[model samples]
Target: MNDVSFLPHARLDDLIQLLLTQGFRVIGPRVRAGVIAYDTIDAATQLPWGWRDAQAPGRYRLEQTAGSRCFAWANGAQAIKPFLFAPREPLWQARRAAGCFEVQELVPPPRPLAFLGVRACDLAALAIHDRHFLGGLHPDPYYAARGEEMLLIAVNCTHPADTCFCAATGDGPQAAAGFDLALTELDDGFVAQAGSQEGRELMQALVLAPATPEQRAAASQAIGLAAAAQTRRLPAPERLRRLYQRLDHSRWEDVGARCLSCGNCTQVCPTCFCHREQDVPALEGEATVHERQWDSCFSAGHAWLHGYQVRPEIRQRYRQWLTHKLAGWQAQFGRSGCVGCGRCISWCPVGIDLTEEVEVLLAEAADGA
Candidate 1:
């Protein structure tokens, strides 16, 4: 089967219908309360057509255009992370019996999901999560169940936000891999490619014609322009690996002065995987439910130990998060945790740009040398 095909804008609903027939709950990007967010969709009309977003440090705004594009925006406040690594979930339930207690694991049943318009940076983050949750010595059954059968339909980025730096992270502007189907949106239609057996079967079912050379070239050129337009960048991995050694760097104190300690960066970050667990007792005292929710190193409670906080100061917490995200993550996962999606920059109330912080921190080290 030919991997590359042209899907006319009009026939997009046909593809959604086919996924529905295959028992997938199709989720796509939609304009919700003036923001492009992922939601369930039954037809192509639900997509944010002719909509674009302008993003900057501590700012995001929606703009309407006279175009027919559905994915002209960069990304939303949240990624597919919440879908797999649920913000809050019950781990187990304990029932009090006549003589003993019975525990029931609360692993959720797998639901087939088809996500449309996944960005390349998000795909890279998803790969890091796969390594964290599934490639560990003890696999996370909860995350595994949710992600095992998920279908990824990637949309190559052509309109990157000013805050976006996926190109510097080597993760974006084009869909390189980790997708079933990849689409490059054009004004008239989309240039689609199948990356998996299931994706090939679906393309065959769509019966789309092979994309013309002109269409393919246009898509490639648009992605290239998008890449070139990004002004933000992160230091190379080699320099980032030394970030932990700068624990007492003055930049930490400088950034900490403006930091809110609100953990918004960790929450918006695509690859931050800290979580906390607690047990909730039932009102009747007959049961207790153990639940886990997302956590952040920015929280004072995260470093709590023996009734004392290890990172009590805001500067220490800020340093901890930055060093761990850029340096410690490499030691543990063989890659930096940041995928350069820039959600941390735009969603932050104070707009603490980690890329800017890293450059300043590393530049000082080079000058001192």
Candidate 2:
């Protein structure tokens, strides 16, 4: 394939303008409440520009970074789930009048998303979700349409977080797949590369010219530097499969104790797409509401069935989740449920790191005579 480079600097402004015209509500990271979050951003200025965030266990603070640094922060408080799957949406409503029932289906609002500043890990998470919701036997019409239509303008991580482990999972510090456009922040301009037809059209619309040899070189160097800056990484990938197949007993109890049963890890995890359904009633029982909300295997309710809850032990629940992401998901979907975004590790109130936990399991498993 010919190395296609579009007009570098002009593409940024053009992308903004094009997205606006395309009826997409553009969103990216912005500074709020002393941290970075994904929010409705009008212009590039809304981005956490020139600011690098400091993240450690139980701490996240954004400090002023070098000149014009966009996407300097890794995944913050929220992943892409809330936007794709709304916190609450009426699944359908049933109305009863005079002992008669009528059913009404609910269709969610369609707002074509232009996810600016998406990281490679989030892109990978989207793919993971795509496997279940889109590629499954019963596809979710709600999620499928949005997934198919959303445009991703990925930001190659110029900086990664302390908890991030995408490198180990072969997801990225640099985007290799599942992006319409990929960007690497540079001193003067962003190195923009288009990966698909939509991106190519946008580039053409933006009137981006062929990149200079030096610009192409700069992009390559930027990707390399980002790949190296990953502060946390795992040594093995193939071994994870075996580790999951046979879990170690030693580390399991300690993790269960540290885990608050808060289920924050699963809530924050990018690829954890489980949800529970509920029926809600309107005033006077004239009408009823049915809804689907996000659920986690970590939760006590997840195992509830036949008037009893299985996996009642916190240890069992945690083990099941980790096992599924590594081994069970592969058996079912032929892919790992985890995107290696590190959201579970970073946002867990107790700082329960999945990478550390995985390593422990594998180490103990190997030692058993």
- Candidate 2 Cα outliers beyond 4 Å, as residue runs: 1-3, 6-11, 235-237, 244-248, 367-369
Could you give candidate 1's per-residue lDDT for residues 1-369 as a string of tens digits?
A: 789999999999999999999999898998898788888999999999999899999998999898888988899988889999999999999998997999999999999999999999999999999998999589999999998789999999999999999999899978899999999999999999998998898899999999999999999999999999999988878888878778778888899899999999899888999999999999999999999999999998999999999999999998989888888888898888888899999988998888899988898676444
List model 2 lDDT by residue over 1-369, tens digit each. 233564444246567877988888887788888877788876766777678766666557778866566666777877676778665677788998678998987866667888888888888887777776777578887776555568888888867777776777788878888888887777666777888988888777776657778877887787677667666655354566775655556688988888878888778777887789999888796999999988889888899998999989888889989888787777777767776677777677777777778777777556442
Worst 10 residues of 2 by lDDT: 1-10
lDDT values of the candidates?
Answer: 0.92, 0.75
lDDT for 310 in candidate 1 is: 99
Off by over 4 Å in 1: none
